[model samples]
Target: MRNWTISGTLTVEPAEQRTDLLAEPVAKALAALESPDAGVVEIDPELADTGAFCEAYSSPMSASANCVVVAGKRAGEVRYAAALVLATTRADVNGVIKRRLDVRKASFAPMDEAVELTGMAYGGITPVGLPADWPILIDKAVADSPELVIGSGIRGGKLLVTGELLASLPGAEVIEDLAKPVA
Candidate 1:
């Protein structure tokens, strides 16, 4: 695994070092990657949210990337996608994402629906194991980052990966302004 400059107190090891901490699809996805140079760290499930996780782990908020599932409809067909943005920002679902998805309107997917479709826990949906057809819109800021902490498909842990790796995922697209700075 690559050295993580943003790693916190949580010990980061190879994804295989603790498969028990990864979700089924997340583990499979990492295994399928050509390099799988990511690291995994176990954490308190209750602190999975970005704010809590970063604060408790002594990790900087800017070093965390958050993934949110979005839903839209066009011609009676529902379209699903994920937006990845730095913790310091928020995905522009109503603007950039909606336009990119070619939908009249886009909104965060329902908790139950998102979990059911992605097979990931509600608070732990990473972009790694999304449906093959779903597009993953990554903010340019995230792609330019050296390293970031992202969800591990479950609330109990997180994955440490490089921006280049995430930008190379199956359906990933780097967008210049996919997100807006949080106030």
Candidate 2:
């Protein structure tokens, strides 16, 4: 276990760094959560819908929604930003993120760029392991779900938690009108 808590910073690092969710990792985290409410659900990696359902979609699963975190550099300075967009819609990157990052121009960091800097799998990118300075953009839709499955530091696994719980994670912030459903 590689769990760590910042005594003054109010942050927590996992005890062990697992690539994805297995029964063991899930079970351990479930037991560790302050509130153990959401149930475990298995998802297939090959199917985008499955990942979306378990990780981003909210209909099939009671607690699920989309998440997109953008990282990039502007004017020779590095920045990390994220959006917990509902799977139903795509992020309004130009609308919300540009202002949030305080730049006239902004875009989703390349997949390779995000993976390299965040040190988390593309699909597995969660707010948990994110850098302290990163800014998060959470969708209002998440409030509707009882719980939501976000990344678990690994693409193959998910962390099932309540919306409130997810909000409670370190470096997480709730944003209203962050995006609109994709047409």
Candidate 3:
């Protein structure tokens, strides 16, 4: 399944790539840069053992980019949002996310359900392929980075791009409080 999305370049959007959880961020990215290598694979054996996150592999400043998918209750409506943050710190959902969406309770989407609904593997859900209705939050830190290695709409690879470009994704909403300080 991963191989299906691992194409060199695409001439048209594939239906199987779309999902209710997120938009096809990578496709927009491809159109943005006009370069296919914008998203590439890093299949080093060391990374294979690091689980879904990359913070443990290096400092937050050096880690690959990450985004958090949140399922919450907003305005009496059950909604979903994705927050892009560096793995060094956790997404400040209660303080950052809750306040932005005017929601009372915002929590990380359950792992089992996140993978199932997002249509991506546990560690591979990217901002792309997310539903249009869902709000995507970008941490200031992510926007500050020179480039980010975010998920490439798949589990086996990631897209390395400028933080500013990521912020420009059609439905992305940039916000502060992407994380909490290390205690």
Candidate 4:
């Protein structure tokens, strides 16, 4: 349990308190993972995007994990997955992800579709409350990190969670090389 602190400027709160803006599923998921090591920090909604959040809060880009929703078709059925990768890397969507989904192609889900389906705002979707059937592919590095900053299902806050806890979340799967280094 490393000390998980947002830069001094942000106010930390029990994750449960900020659930008002979370989609129902996300709120429920966060509730289940409530623990001393897991909490939320509220920030300016304007800085919710990963780059801004990290720069504004002075959080290391390596410690921030982005949860991206990807969609593909397999067997004439639409399939979706949530890919978790550190800000320093990119999910291997066209390589590892396409193979995993057994789809001919895979791409980021349409912003509108992702937002509507996850009940989370664009740029604020976290893996915590994704549909049960969706696979949550967490890069090995992210799952091995002692602590990470992730979305709180809304643009107004960020969640602090341990790698172990995140890996234990429902549907989470830690995969080696799930992401490729950004070059």
Query: Which candidate's TM-score is highest?
Result: 1
Candidate 2 has an lDDT of 0.57
lDDT of 2 by residue, 87-161 (tens): 666777887777788776778788887777667667766655565677767776775555455655455555555
**Alpha-carbon lDDT, every model:** 0.92, 0.57, 0.61, 0.85
In candidate 4, how many clashes are counted? 0
Q: Against the true structure, candidate 4 has what lDDT?
A: 0.85
Judged by lDDT against the true structure, how good is candidate 1? 0.92
Error of 2 at 128 (Å): 2.2
**For candidate 1, lDDT tens digit of each residue in 1-183?**
577877778788998778888888988888899977799989999999999999999989999999999999999999999999999999999999999999999999999999999989989999998899999999999999888999999999899988998999999999999999988
Clashing pairs in 1: none
* Pairwise lDDT winner, candidates 3 and 4: 4
C-alpha lDDT of residue 132 in model 3: 68
What tens digits encode model 4's per-residue C-alpha lDDT throughout 32-72? 76463566887789999889998888888888999999999
Query: Please, what is the TM-score per model?
Result: 0.98, 0.70, 0.70, 0.93
lDDT of 1 at 63: 92
After TM-score superposition, what is the CA distance of residue 178 in candidate 3 from its true location, in Å?
A: 2.4
Kindly give the stretch of ten consecutive residues in candidate 3 with the minimal lDDT sum: 1-10
lDDT of prediction 3: 0.61
Q: List residue ranges in candidate 1 displaced over 4 A.
A: none
How far residue 31's Cα lies from its native spot in candidate 4, in Å, is: 1.7
Best by lDDT: 1
Candidate 3: segments with Cα more than 4 A from true spot = 1-37, 44-63
